[model samples]
Target: MNVTETKRKVEINDLYKLSTAYDAQLSPDGKSAVYVVRKINEETAQYVSNLYVVDLETKEERQWTFGEHLHQTPTFSPDGAMLAFVSNRTKTNQIYLLPVNGGEAKQLTFFHKGASNPIWSPDGNMLLCSAGVKSGETIHTKEEQNEKKELQPLVVDRLIYKADGRGFIKDTYSQIALIHIDSGESVQLTQGDHSYAASCWSPDGTAVVYSANLSDDPDAVFTSDLYVYNIDSKETVNLTTGQGSFGRASWSPDGSYLAFLGSQEENQTVTTTKIWLYDFSAQKMHCITQEWDVDVEDVGVGDLHSWRRNPGLIWTADSEGFYFLMSDQGNVGVYHGTVEGELTPVLFENLHVYDLSVHSNGQQAVVGISTPTLPGELYTLNLTSGDREQITHLHDTFLDDVVLAGAESFTIKASDGWDLQCWLMKPAGYEEGEKYPLILEIHGGPHMMYGNTFVHEFQTLTASGYGVLYINPRGSKGYGQVFADAVRGDYGGKDYQDLMDAVDYVIREYDFVDEMRLGVTGGSYGGFMTNWIVGQTDRFKAAVTQRSISNWISFYGVSDIGYFFTEREIKSDLYDNIEALWKHSPLRLADKVNTPLLILHGELDYRCPIEQGEQLFNALKRKGKETRFIRFPEATHDLSRSGDPKLRLDRLTYIRDWFHQYV
Candidate 1:
């Protein structure tokens, strides 16, 4: 099938359609546009995501690829004649090139492993991509051979053990690669056990800058250095030699400056998140957005009515300033930052913003917005008045035909008086004095936040006779750097308290919450919190921990980001306090857990690793406590959002079943 047809067959599972969004983009000339479409197939147990092109002038939309594959990372060529994207149509994800007008999509690279994050070269003839190596290829191949031959006598000795949904695994390692669009050849530009991840082409297209941690530390995961690779020499020169984790790098249009956001020092969890601009010629680093001492990321909600997430940062027409995301004053808004370091806020309010695109003219920007009462929709925003106009009517058909539950946003002070913000989704037919079963849904990203965006799980939970509560706990971002770091070195301390406090406030304030029949669920850090919560308190009758960290010691060596993340979050290395890591580990306290728990893990999860669940389940079983672990054989860390559609649905079903059995 062609590109447009591929997009047309994009069907989404009704249960969790809003888990992610298709972000639209405008071209340099603003004559045409690009957007992403996502679908989930339950029968196939897969997610179908692809890119589509539309001619704004002609009002035409077309797909770019076809077949049982996932396509993403679509970028426009400088001349706007070709589109570059990464696809797994060949079984392993790799870069593919296609014409914007339409034609047979050309396969650019053939790697035994998968590739991701494709960016067009300045000249548009070559595409830069990130390459990942299967952690234990030789052993894995042998496992496949043994399984096919009907033998089961392989040795099971490895530091990195079995992946829950996947088979025995070690880890995922990735470096940067450059694919030649015309020749269909690729070259590994960076090398080492220290993986180089993020990829971005310099504005001038002379160098490709990325984040890598080619560290001497054997288990170092977060020690990434900013480096520029010369395509001609196949050489990489390290830029930021300092010790810090750099994320999401973007170069200023002038190429003289490169920018990325990161914490400033080593072993610092609450370091101020600053936009650092490095001078290519001066070899110096200067910090931007100095006014606020808080951390910033995917910040700012432009409007609730539009649709999108992770609003893209666009440069002004003159390149004098950059327009991107910032959340301050308890709101998310677009802010324009000048070259000299003056930060100006453009849009603000209690809206969740994502997938932002700026018109070539620079006077206006378009974003996806969602409010408390609506599903996400696309909208065009006048950067000047904050006046926004709705664009596509995506879900009005389904929404108008069904009775939808409403979400209410409120803030309550924690025990320490730190203002904690939360979103409560009451059951559709919620009645006064009716005590409804409550599901305390926690978010991950110990650095992320709860927002006004529509969450399918929350709505579904509310529809299923449960009240859902999600809060931006202490470690959550948007509350300033201090509060975000407040949970550092004290993982289950204040963050747990904050979550429990919210539960208490909800039970006291809302008569609909059946506190005695409470259920808790979370992924990643939230998963870790759930595990910790069950260990510390039995308030929750049922608990589901998705891709959680049960033991920090095992986690530090097994997970893709475990090494640095462990130290970064715990404020110490594994040896620094192996006992502390264990003490802080939810598994260590598992003997105290009596809550009926459901452990949901992805077979391919690398972030928290599946052994987390293994350890927890084994402990619970030894204790003869009620617990069950369900492993999604082909899912990843994002089982709820990016995992197999069937598995995603099954995940909800399993949680509901487990809760139903216990609650």
Candidate 2:
């Protein structure tokens, strides 16, 4: 086929056709790897994830398990004889097992709140998982209550009584449980008012390491201490001693040490996640990445697969060190870290390694990588030589007909003398001498980076004949802790100038960008910046803000994270610095916004509640300014990334149409 013939514009609906790979787990022999590939069912408009296995030797791949429901968290048995995964096919999500060689999956558990994160015991005769149940109730009783016909009023008691996606916080607490494979019997391991996080299976199979606050008031404390629970003795021992928030536990091959990722800082959200090693002999914890400036996980946010979880701490066979993904600058790379605080780059490239799995021999590794042009795919790599071979052709057929824009990364010095990293994606089918409208895109997280990853929204904007400009402003991770923390107390100060300077750099340097037809858009922190940008200047013709924060005063009480996030990030308290909070609030300057703005928010978004959008929309409308607000029902703060498939598409459509209408 000719070059132009291969370049077809990517459509919004193409989101349904793209397949995403996640969580690759290598077998004990390292000859095979199984991972979850998620795709949208066009007919049902729902995301369905199924297990897929790949032969590492011949590079042959096949679907290992299939069902209409979501299948995820695939883990290999100790003997590599069976594969256990969590599936929602049953009435509730439960553990299911399928023989490695070949067989139908057998449902293993029937817990009321379902089971997840299945880890097989060393003996391969049992599995350990977590399931939510009432504080003092049995699974059967809870299931029976759920199956009851009569309706009852919901009683709220806990300080944290509600979550964004989950409307009301039920009394159920996630507990650790052990399930026998042969007898189909399950035993509860730990139970309390507190919920347990994911755990690591001890090498000898006698214990499991888990994390929980276990505090008298969990909502009042930010500590998540690691604990070891003896399966035989049923005794729990605290490992972290409530020093800091810690989780993502990984046991050494010989069980001499346990490694996890966390921070001991008081300002938890702004603190960088570093690797911590707990020595069994000394009974002490050491921060292995204390000198390392990078964030020790995949925090480079994206829309296509924001639900994607980091591979966590993957231990090498010898237990001398481990391989982990660290966010530095604009890339998340796999790094080999020694127990002695040394980090060696293994796969440090202009790519996002979201998840990875190393072989038992530590010679071969499977990685989930995404680039600006590539959505996401699984690739097998030779750890010694760093040679990678793409093993899956999931979206090959679909991407063949898609025309992706060329992304160029550049660095510009902000007015405050900080080097800001930015990327510019040219519009698809660009001609040599033609000028196109540009959309200045800001990423949420003010802490998240606009890295070298595939962002579907940016692609969709480029496909619609717009150049996309995205920058990693201050307060954005990957650029050292200092640069990331720079915006904590100065939200609209230097960070705002970094974005403006990035836009000016592109407009001044790039000849093909139309200066008159400028557009701006972002979600969350990006949304907050978009609101601030239009208020500060009317250079952009239009702007779209999603799940944005408008008023810090009200946000302190209304947002799920309002109380602390406001005090921590903004460095302002409602009682003392109420005026300062209002000063930085975008809603305070709403009367100055002249650019046609569109506010999109999730109705159930507790992170940045819909009230934030409502306030902005009301302010602009009451002033007779051009503005619009669109709310996605039952959608949470993750609407752009993991919300309903249709709603995500509609949100993209709204963004494209809004920019088209003004810019």
Candidate 3:
């Protein structure tokens, strides 16, 4: 092969491909798979997702869904005769059935409430799906509503809940429903004035084991419990009764036992829950991998796997051994485990892994893998031999000419004496004795982690001729819970020290860093930290904060989950200790800031509303500090991840320009 072929890259417009890749589900026999393809066009300003099926043996592919309507979540019936999926072709998300052999699809349900999570019964006669309307909305027939109580204002108990991202105006409750294939009538499985979701049909198809916070205090929406609904007995049983978050419950294929994930109620610290398995015969429960050594990443253990199915737990064909995604060092990989505790590695990813789906045959799988230098693409993996093959070439062309930077790993001791692992990505063509601007990048979820994987933004920023330093710092996962929770009640205390220490260590050791031209940027919680950093110190020349929080007092009432998250993380209640919140608010120290700051926000961002951006920008402006704010109208909290492809590229360009201009 030519050298050019060896370095060949893919692009978004490649025929039969997409700019963004998403869910891929394999056929029962593992001989075929259908995946969702997302296309982004520069000319039409169009982005669309369509369904396509690939025949493994024949290498033949065909489009299964068409038209302007979007389709997703396609599943083949057990017998492999029909394809069932949820689509918005009719302008509402509804379930439809089509003969896989070939032909038009038949629309099933007709409720104005709409439907979601289309799961076919094992026998393929009845489809077990979750259908609902908006919570607290009056569910009345057209005639009844015309003659009865005009809709009253909906009152919600919880501080945070999900609003439908798309579909018709929802005015109903969320609940699990059973769709009769013949009659098309959806029977209310579990019903109440309260909301419930994330359900899976039991092994015997007689009931559904799901997680809910129905009885949980609305103000405190974190607690949940495992509840089973019996279709035959018309009974709902609280299996693992407690005020804990229990989720992703799956039944053993034999119906002899059930497996799920749960954490204790003792502390509010964010950590991975153990995989819990309960045997009906013994009426006892045991955690599959409770050791400090392992963490659950996906769903079931064996051949076919399912994660939390959008809402709750559901079992898979391979329940004999549990399989989960985990990270050790910087590597994230798949591991195999027996329900009794025997566990082994399947795939230790050298890059970030996503979209991992297993086949019932237990021999093959598909996943999206990325390294610090790579974007992401689908790859096929062989289970037995640990072999991997690239299945999709999504963006090779844009990357070919771009000389990407690779990660250089190192470590430093935090001021608190804790050893902190760190990594640096140098710009392409980096040379010794050349001074370079540096950007300290932090990740969000303070509970989430950044591992050894390909991050496009990291590469893109480096290519713009700057060194990027990313640190997990304290409160990051992968390390034990103690280390992860080190900054719990202390936001800018030790965790802030850990970050500054990393920068100090780098500045002391790396002569190429122009300390006077330093910059800092992060998103979400990272955004909060960025705002805090600029306010606390004027060491950095420039700063950028994305989806950030400025004032803790206002965040508690404005941002989604701000009501609960602030109380838990910031540990200051508005009415009880409003002073502490003011002290911790990044805006409080705005007077100390001299660095030029840029605030990027999404208008539809309920997670950390755009008001946070306005507050920070207004604060810096009032203090006579340089500040700018840009907002994406249709974007949400995922402005970086699932934002418009063109806009995502534009945001990266903006960040690069701001840093280059000031630093």
**What does each candidate score in C-alpha RMSD?**
6.4, 1.6, 4.6
**Which runs in model 2 stand beyond 4 Å of their true positions?**
145-151
| TM-score for each candidate, following the candidate numbering | 0.83, 0.97, 0.89
Lowest lDDT 10-mer window, candidate 2? 139-148
Candidate 1 whole-model C-alpha lDDT, 0 to 1: 0.72
Best by TM-score: 2
Ranking by TM-score: 2, 3, 1
- On a 0 to 100 scale, what is the lDDT of residue 292 in model 3? 53
- For model 3, the stretches where C-alpha displacement exceeds 4 angstroms are 1-18, 67-69, 134-172, 298-319, 399-401
Against the true structure, whose lDDT is highest? 2
Please write out the lDDT profile of model 3 over residues 215-304, one tens digit for every residue: 646455567788887778888788777646777776777777777777763448566556777888887777766675434553111001
Query: Model 3, clash count?
Result: 18
Worst 10 residues of 1 by lDDT: 3-12
lDDT of 2 by residue, 156-233 (tens): 776577777776767877888889999999988777688887568889888899899888877778889999988778
lDDT of 2 at 308: 71
What TM-score should be assigned to candidate 1?
A: 0.83
Kindly report the root-mean-square deviation of model 3 from the true structure over all alpha carbons: 4.6
